[model samples]
Target: MNHDSYDDNYIRGILNGVKSIAMVGASPVNVRPSYFAFKYLAQRGYDMIPVNPGHVGKSLLGKPFVASLSDIGRPVDMIDIFRNSSHIMPVVDEALTLSPLPKVIWMQLGARDDAAAERAEAAGLKVVMNRCPKIEYGRLSSEISWMGVNSRTLSSKRAPIPTQGMRLSLNRTSVGGGATTASDRAAKNRSEPT
Candidate 1:
């Protein structure tokens, strides 16, 4: 079986076109990857609908957690899956069964379902398997600092030196008022030696 390369324009178009996302298996826990990715998308203006059977009726990031796709009344532009590959077929089936099919079906990193993706593609939906949308967005837009390396744009002024186990403090003085804000103090603490 031959796998085709993912088109850059196709990926970009799906990313730009998506407005609302139904995140399946979204956990309320912040330590989870799904939680962070969900928060990131929500912060970036995507309407996030968390889907978790165990957490139904609970609120995550100010949005209610739904048990299943069928429970959601509003239109879903995309279904970003965080579930395992074994359980993905049913989710794809449900998404495709909707009156208006979702624009995209994105499988999280390390989660790949070729059959489900093929079904989605056959149903005229854009399929992204084994890809993290949040990572893609940051990478494509150059928002990823790579620990302040690689690109010499805004982060070229000062290089991040290896301090090993050493602690540093940063200081900043406010203009006109001569008072420093909390952020300024924090920044100063980060750059100065303890």
Candidate 2:
């Protein structure tokens, strides 16, 4: 099926079922989007393995940081990439080699490599590019407030906050940004034609 056919509901289902995720390029700095995204996922009860060579042997959000996907020595439901386009291939390659293979390879916003994504898709893995799983989750599940400005107002005389920010806005209600929000990431499990 075409990429456009894989809608928010489908992605959300996948996210809901995933129990663990390998966060490639996860950073120790809390200010980084990846760090917060990983933290958010962890808070939501998903096991998050931080993958960063420099931070190997350390931990983020209490999960050990591995140098690579294989270093995790266990099955990972997904590989959530936070690296740049230029650095994504190796991660995809490694993810492809995993025994069970990852159910999904999610490229964070501003990070897309057509070749790498094609490889993953060709290997029978679900691939999402340039979309934040977190944003979609919030919108599809009504976890975040998306009521836009109208004659009605939540507070007296104040305008509604437009769902715009570091996250890419989809459908005027769903906002995706930074490393993709936890809610958006959870949206990755929706079942549709892939």
Using lDDT as the measure, the top candidate is 1
Separate clash counts for every candidate: 11, 25
Model 2: C-alpha RMSD to truth?
10.0
Candidate 2 lDDT over residue span 1-80, tens digit each: 34422555457657766778888989999898888787766755677789999987788877888898988898999999
> How far does residue 164 in candidate 1 sit from its true spot (Å)?
32
lDDT of 1 by residue, 1-194 (tens): 22233444455577778888999999999999999998877876778899999998798989999999988987899999998889899999999988778889998876777898889889898888766887765433334446552211222234345243221111111122211255345544543556
Pick by TM-score: which candidate is best?
Answer: 1
Misplaced by over 4 Å in model 2 are 1-6, 146-194
After TM-score superposition, the amount by which residue 133's alpha carbon in candidate 2 deviates from its true location, in angstroms, is: 2.5
Cα deviation of 160 in candidate 1 (Å)? 23
Question: What TM-score does prediction 2 earn?
Answer: 0.72
